[model samples]
Target: MLPSVTFLAKFSPAHRRTITASAIHLTPWQPSSPQAEHASLSMMADKCKSMDQLKQIHAQMIVTSRIHDTFAASRLLNFCALSASGDLNYALKLLEHTPMPNLFMWNTVIIAQASSSSPFEGLLLYADMRRRGVVPGKHTFPFVLKACSNMKSVRCCEQVHAHVFKFGLDSDLHVVSGLVRGYSVSGGIGDARRVFDELGNRNLSIWTTMICGCAQNDSAEEAIRLFDGMIADGFEPNEVILCSVLSACAQSACLVLGEQIHEYIEEKGMELDVILGTALVNMLLRTDHWLKQNSAFMD
Candidate 1:
């Protein structure tokens, strides 16, 4: 009986290691011979894939006193809250119990809130971060601005803009791009353009944002004009830019311009890709008269 018990104990550790390694990366606590309760807690954390799994893990941890370890508990909270399939509530609960959460901990929760479908929570988290005297960093602004965009809260966006200026991050290309996109999404194309114009050196993403803003506002002519300017500026049109240009053509039924773009795509060897080819076909079909005339000319 003693030999069998020892064998089972040894087997449990190896089995847990195998399971953890297969599902997620192993943590240091995983290899230690925890008490039966701690061992079970580790096992629960290993198998957590959804909110329900996290809840089971939490219950097991509570029963096993494994929650006493702050680091392990914090990790559990992060995993449960931030995992693709984990529950937000579970993560929050873990955070609440954390004695003195670090910046990383705060950032993780803030990001999780920002990325949730209801972005208002992200804004709230930002407010909480501020109240706690945590200085917002470059990483924080994008997520905060994204939440403002999602909520279409222009006032909040303006407030965030002020924060960006205060942080001297207003000139950051990525932050500037986010501000442009946020303004555009909030139906303030003028504001977006204003931000774009202030950019020191515009990248393709900034140009794309402006183009998309024009297209969404039924200003395809403006988008096309901008596309021409971008090309003249010697910025090679990438796949995203090409897609945006094609969208503008489809909207305006500018078959002549669309054909020119199609030709460019062919020359660039992008026409061989099924996705772009399909988009080109759809654009041509939308202007069938022009396509037929072009085919006749070729024949």
Candidate 2:
């Protein structure tokens, strides 16, 4: 296994997940290209434990004129932008200084910005990328849309959705999921459902996204309807979807369906963590109140 990510605390949990996943694909510096000193230095940036070591490597690359190699420059940019101890400002400066920043460099910085506290900056960066005539690939939209989701900007969500279709990335599941979330959070449930339905094939995650979107938007009937559809499609509901549907049931006072879901949870031996447990309790409370009212009125 690769070295433990010692600098994890410096980033948000989202960025930490991005870094951890990248570690598997990131190879150590290859020293075999003896004639290409820059290749060896680029590898060092991947293994850089701290900013000081990274700076030392950067200085060496500049002194050797290896900074001109876009690939070499990208390694330094990646470390600064995404690594825990490294600096985002420095990474931004490096990209600004580079004459031609590649797609990977754009993605690294965008991901960092998307998960950062100031996610709006991510949207600005994406706009700058487009202004520079850089066409975004599949990896780009998710982060861009994430920034939109964080800001809860309905206009921004619609704008991003336009780009998704313009680039023919509307079918990409990750990007689609981001759209569902962005639209949902911004109170654009109709748009969210439209996007969800347009997809020819949907995954469990997309289904969950649509259901949660409906539930959160006060479309309890739609949320419960979708949940039943999901089951018919052979998708097993996970904890998140269950919680969302339970919220829907609570809103609609769906006593029979709510009880059925509770039984299903028990049958599946699902753990009742805080979120799931709270959703369950809320559903029961609401339904029970309805029951008591109906019984009292009958008398």
Clashing residue pairs in all predictions, respectively, total 0, 1
Model 2: per-residue Cα lDDT over 145-259, one tens digit each: 8888888898999998999999999999999999999999989999999999999999999999999999999999999999999999999999999999989999998878987
Candidate 2's C-alpha runs over 4 A off are 1-36, 287-299
- The local distance difference test score of each candidate is 0.72, 0.82
User: 27, model 2: CA deviation in Å?
Assistant: 20
lDDT of 2 at 246: 89
Q: Which 10 consecutive residues of model 1 have the lowest summed lDDT? A: 1-10
Error of 2 at 38 (Å): 3.6
Root mean square deviation (Cα) for candidate 2: 10.0
Judged by whole-model lDDT over C-alpha atoms, candidate 1 comes out at 0.72
The regions of model 1 sitting more than 4 angstroms off are 1-74, 271-279, 289-299
Clashing pairs in 2: 29-43
- Candidate with top lDDT is 2
